[model samples]
Target: MTAITEALRRLPKVELHCHVEGTMRPSTVVELASKNEIELPTSDPTQLYRYTSLDTFLEIFWLVQSVLGDGDDWARLAYESAVDGAEHGLVYRESFFTPARHLDAGQDLGDIVAGLAEGCVAAEEATGVRIMLIADIDRAYGPGPGLEMVQRLVELRRANAPGTDRVLGIGLDSTELGVDPTDFAPAFELAGRSGLRRTSHQGEVTPPTTIRAGVDVLGCERIDHGLSLLDDPELTQRFVDERIPLTVCPNSNIRIANAYPRLELHPYARMRELGLLATLNTDDPALTDLDLTYEYRSVMDAFGYTWDDMVTIALDGVEGSWLDPTDAGALRARITADADQLASSLATG
Candidate 1:
């Protein structure tokens, strides 16, 4: 490997947009399906993730969700995701979990949180990679169920549950095409009142107005897949001025045909040029067949980013994270020190 690729791999990183369900190992999915007697479109693990469209991918995504029958499955998935992330240089992660799906499947919220918390605590102890949860409101289920999910989360917090304590926020995910961000305002408001942070998926396939609604109506603190922000100069300027962080998944966008069809045309580089606090992520590492290291290398090659530019993006991930000020500051300092040392070594070597 070149010095740049090696350095990127060694660099400490943070991921704020990964999905826990989407990170399930392919072998684990096959095993879980067998154990649960769940039928899948394909029994072959290699063939399970092949998808030509977003709709097809969601079909598989839900199929994987079906295999997770109880708290143990959720806990195992959480633990494995952290282990896999640590192998990829992850220092911290905030993963999105769709509780609505599990609840619809007859899983209890408390059990789900307990299981995930167990996995997170063990993973943190073993790998020193801090993992937090973001309970996602499935937009396809509409507003009432979304509101109920947030209320349940509030109740869990009130009870001082183990797993719920790590759930720092609420995120809107799944099938954003027909859904309006405004529809979930009441739920997000409840989350705000309950002391939960807010974020949502917008601008991947939707227009800039959806992003506006997420921020203005839903009070989103960060935006996921916000590629369409480039469409509105005024809105883009506001995001720049406000330093709203966007977690962009380049390969996922290309795979799903949402943004630019080619990696070279992706707006990630332009987003950085516009000073939009853009950070790279693997939205669904297992499904996308990518890791954070590959993302860093892809952007470097696509945008001709130097190691210093990579450092800037890495720091953006730290600053954009939901980590408390004290933890974020310490992480920033460590990353700054390590990155400088790497850059200095590269210069002299």
Candidate 2:
């Protein structure tokens, strides 16, 4: 492989929009289901993740979350999930976990947290990848349960303490079609009060107006699937000016059949051209059947990205992450050094 391509292979990335349930390895999912005596909707692992429609995909997604029935399930799920991310050249991964989904399945919140914490520790040790949890509150369930979910999430995070150094942020997910960002102001405010980093899925299925509502009303520091944010030129200009990082999942969006079919038609390249902070991610790796390196390469192969363009986007991920300044600086330097090495090789060639 060329030096640039090799750099892309070993180049580390920070994942900001990964879903814990959707990211489970199909093999691991079956093992967990078998161990817990939970029946899967699809016994075959390959057929389990062949999702096309957004609605059906969500149905299957919730079904798998159901198989993770107890706290130990959460621990094993969390731990095993991170290893997959690490193996894919990801140095840092913040997984979105919805405890309410598990607890509503009759699993206790404490147990779920305990299991996830165990998995986080094991995964970190196994792969040398740092992992963090982003507590996700499903909007379709309404704000009352969301309020309780956040409270329990905070308690869960505090309970694990130093062992699970990975619990870091809160995210708003689930269908955004009916739920307005303003509906859960109280929950977000509570998250802010608790000092958790905040992000939300805003415009994946909604118009650019919904993105405005999220930035103005909900006060999210970063946005997941904020593709529609490009619709408004002035607003897009502001996004570029502010450098608000957007975690763009082109394959995931296309898999949902929500966006254009081709990668060039996606907002990722436009976001980059406008100088907006855009980072690539596998929102659901198993569902999309790809990793960070593969996603980066596909984006390049489809969009014809140059070495500098790709490296700059990698740097943007480090700048856009919730990592402490020191960590961010370290990752940034690694990208820079890799880029320089690739350039030197190109010059020699």
**Predicted model with the maximum TM-score:** 1
Task: State which candidate has the highest lDDT.
Answer: 1
Per-candidate RMSD, Å? 1.2, 2.2
Model 1: per-residue Cα lDDT over 8-84, one tens digit each? 88789999999999999999999999989998878888988877787788877888888988888888999999999
Give the alpha carbon lDDT tens digit for every residue of 1-349 in model 2. 6555566766677788888887787887788889879888778888887666777788777777777866677777787778877765777877788766665666766666567778888887888887778888888778888888778767766775433456676888887887778888888888888888888988898888888877777788888899888888888888888888888888788876457877777878878888888888889877668777778887888789987777887788787789999988988897788678767776786
Poorest 10 consecutive residues of model 1 by lDDT? 254-263
Task: Give the clashing pairs for model 1.
Answer: none
- How well does candidate 1 score on lDDT at residue 275? 89
TM-score of each: 0.97, 0.92
Please identify model 1 stretches exceeding 4 Å from their true place: none
lDDT of 1: 0.89
Candidate 2 matches the true fold with a TM-score of: 0.92
Which stretches of candidate 2 lie above 4 Å from their native place? 1-6, 156-165, 342-349
